[model samples]
Target: MDFYVAFNKTLNRFDLKAIDLARKTDLSMQRVSQFKDGFNVRVDTLQKLLEVMPQEAKRYMLTLVAEGETDSPPSTGG
Candidate 1:
């Protein structure tokens, strides 16, 4: 899944709003909206966003990023 798709999924799962996330992450609403709209953000900004998410959501987003980095399916160990 695309980063934006994962991000939106996380937002939906948490019932979070961009304005609320901006306040929690200390990011501008514009930046958050741009990210939600699929624009790439700086790594530091992405880190800030992740920091405000719940652990489960953060892990899910990171897993997607890791999978994208490897360009392979995630291992499913028996």
Candidate 2:
């Protein structure tokens, strides 16, 4: 399973949208869409996401990504 795909599910479970992430994080819709499209965002964007999530959730997200490391990197990471 793709990390971003799984991550998108997390966002969906919370009823979040790229537009909402963009608004709260002051990021462009394009950028947030890139994320939801299973793209690897800049490290800085992760920083913005970190700001919006609780520490526990952030830790879980990091763990989720790490668990997928051996699976594959997002195409956008290339």
Candidate 3:
């Protein structure tokens, strides 16, 4: 399953609206909207969103992050 799909599913599970979540997490409304619209989110922004999620949903989101990190190419230092 796509990470964004999983994210939205977790949000739905908690009956959370994007606007409310953005406000609660102290993130910009545009940022949350962009995430809901499937724009790739930065790690720090994702962390902020996860921090506000319920424990169950947070665990699922972290699992997705771990999986994604495994799938990414390793960075080459300059």
Candidate 4:
């Protein structure tokens, strides 16, 4: 799955919106939405998002990275 798809799923799983995430990450809502829409996000932005996200979100993000490295990403419920 795409990073944005997983990201959106994480939000959905946690009952969070882009605006809420933006507020928590100290970013603009536009930036958060951009991530959801698959825009290229900066490392700092990614870091900020992860820092503020729930453990499930962080785990999902790790899963995405690990899958990318292994060329066989897992498909699991967010």
Best by TM-score: 1
Look at candidate 1 and tell me the lDDT of residue 51. Answer: 86
Write down the TM-score of every candidate: 0.76, 0.64, 0.70, 0.74
C-alpha lDDT of all candidate models, in order: 0.80, 0.69, 0.75, 0.77
Indicate the TM-score of model 2: 0.64
lDDT of 2 by residue, 1-78 (tens): 465665675575556566777788999988888877878888899689667865665565666566664335445653
Please provide, for model 1 over 1-78, each residue's C-alpha lDDT reduced to its tens digit, 9 standing for 90 to 100: 677767887788668777887999889999999999999999899888888888988887777665753235766879
Q: Candidate 2 regions off by >4 Å? A: 1-3, 69-78
Top candidate (lDDT): 1
After TM-score superposition, the amount by which residue 50's alpha carbon in candidate 4 deviates from its true location, in angstroms, is 0.6
Question: 54 in model 4: Cα distance from truth in Å?
Answer: 1.2
Off by over 4 Å in 4: 68-78
How well does candidate 1 score on lDDT at residue 33? Answer: 91
**Candidate 3 lDDT, 1-78, residue by residue in tens:** 455666776677668778877998899999988888789999889878878888987886556555654324545759
lDDT of 4 by residue, 1-78 (tens): 566777777777678677877999889999988989999899899888888888877796667655753234465858
1 or 3, greater by TM-score: 1
Q: Is candidate 1 or candidate 3 better by lDDT?
A: 1
Q: For candidate 1, list the clashing residue pairs, or say none.
A: none
